[model samples]
Target: MPLARTSDLLAAAVADRRGLPAFNVITLEHAEAIAAGAETADTPVILQISQNAVGFHGGRLLPLARACAEVAAAARVAVSLHLDHVEDADLLRAAPGAGFSSAMFDASHLPHDENVKATAEAAAWAHRHGLYLEAELGRVGGKDGEAPLSAHAPGARTDPAEAAGYVADTGVDALAVAVGSSHAMTTRTAALDHGLIGRLAAAVPVPLVLHGSSGVPDAELRGAVAAGMVKINIGTALNLAFTPAVRAHLAENPAVTDPRKYLDPARTAMAQTVAHLARVVAGGGQG
Candidate 1:
């Protein structure tokens, strides 16, 4: 199946009360691994890339974006390609050109009204290209994807009340809210506020998106689904799963110079993690 729009996937998850997994694709290898996992698991997934990842790839979005589109187009199962944590309007404009069906405008670093205005403008531009727009309400502070440690949660989490206005005023298809998750936590032990999740779900009219979900434990992930999060974004966990395998393969076999031999192990590990996440998010047994 070809890639579907993020809004379509979100709507389906919302109606079914199952949280959809939106996995970040950092490279062409990541995209292939994700498509393989989703096809094998029979789960609809979102293949996403951050602005940070874009810069890392080539200081431009075209390379990874094209990889995402091609991967999604050839995938056996449903896949939606999205650009995430994008604050630059020009980048958002160039995103659809590389075949993104949806994107998130993360203006949380700006002031409140500024964030709102920026989000609205992004929504307008995204709509012009018939793309779905996802915007974050309050700041969810974190280091960029390539950074070492993401900032802690004291001042970065979302405020549900403001989230409602952000969604309504910006005309975004989905809203990413910070209930309690923090970014770049290598471990899955971050605490979440179920009450806040429910409140934000009730307050915001659009389907709720949970960012920084890599730090959230399995139980909390299920609780987030119960609390009405339709789309959940995860990255670091897969990185953890993939990186160790690649490192171990390289360490164990120093003579292996071919990238494929080591990368396949990493890809397999990431596929297993994706399967686990899909099942946990859906509250169902893996296929």
Candidate 2:
């Protein structure tokens, strides 16, 4: 299959009343692992490259984006390349040309009106280029104990009415709403408000996206999807699987210093994690 558009993936998931698991890709191995996992599960998945990941590669994005596109093209199941959490308008502008099928233009850190204006501009540009655009409405908890950007301090749940307004204002293809998940959480204990998810899904015109999904437990993830989340974004869980595999491989074979030796196992571990998450997103968790 060719690289599927992110809009198509989300649309399919919405039609099926299931969630699409979107894995964050940090390296070539990560992209490969995500593709392999989607193939193994016989399901479509989204390959997301974050701004942080781009920075980690020293601002080079095209190479990795092309690699992800190529991987998607060659995969048996559909795969889509998405630029995630992009704050720079320039980067967002460049994404469609650089082979990204979709982007999350994050202006959630800005004031509400500014976020709306910026996201609206991004949505216009994305639409012009035939790319899908996702925008965060309320702040899904950021890392490092940063307060969420809502009237409520800690438990900043997205208001259903506000979500509808935001979507109407910004015209985003998808809306990431803050329910209860926090980003970069290593523990899978985040309690999501499924009612809020349902409300947002009812009120918002676009598909509801669940960011910081790595912090959500498998059962809770299933519930979120059942409640109407179409796109589920995961990052930390892959890293959790990948880093430990590399460490274990290195510890076991101290004499071997080959990057491929350790990385291969790490990739496999992450692939397994992705497959499991994909299955969960596909409503297999209910079984």
lDDT of every model, 2 decimals: 0.81, 0.87
Q: For candidate 2, write residues 209-280 as lDDT tens digits.
A: 888888889999999999998999999999999999999998999999789999999999999999899999
What TM-score would every model get versus the actual structure? Answer: 0.92, 0.94
The number of the candidate with the highest TM-score is: 2
| Candidate 1 residue-wise lDDT, 195-272, digit = tens | 888888888889888788888889999998998888888888889989999999999999999999999999999988
**Candidate 1 colliding pairs, count:** 0
Which residue segments of model 2 deviate by more than 4 Å? 139-154, 285-287
Question: On a 0 to 100 scale, what is the lDDT of residue 229 in model 2?
Answer: 89
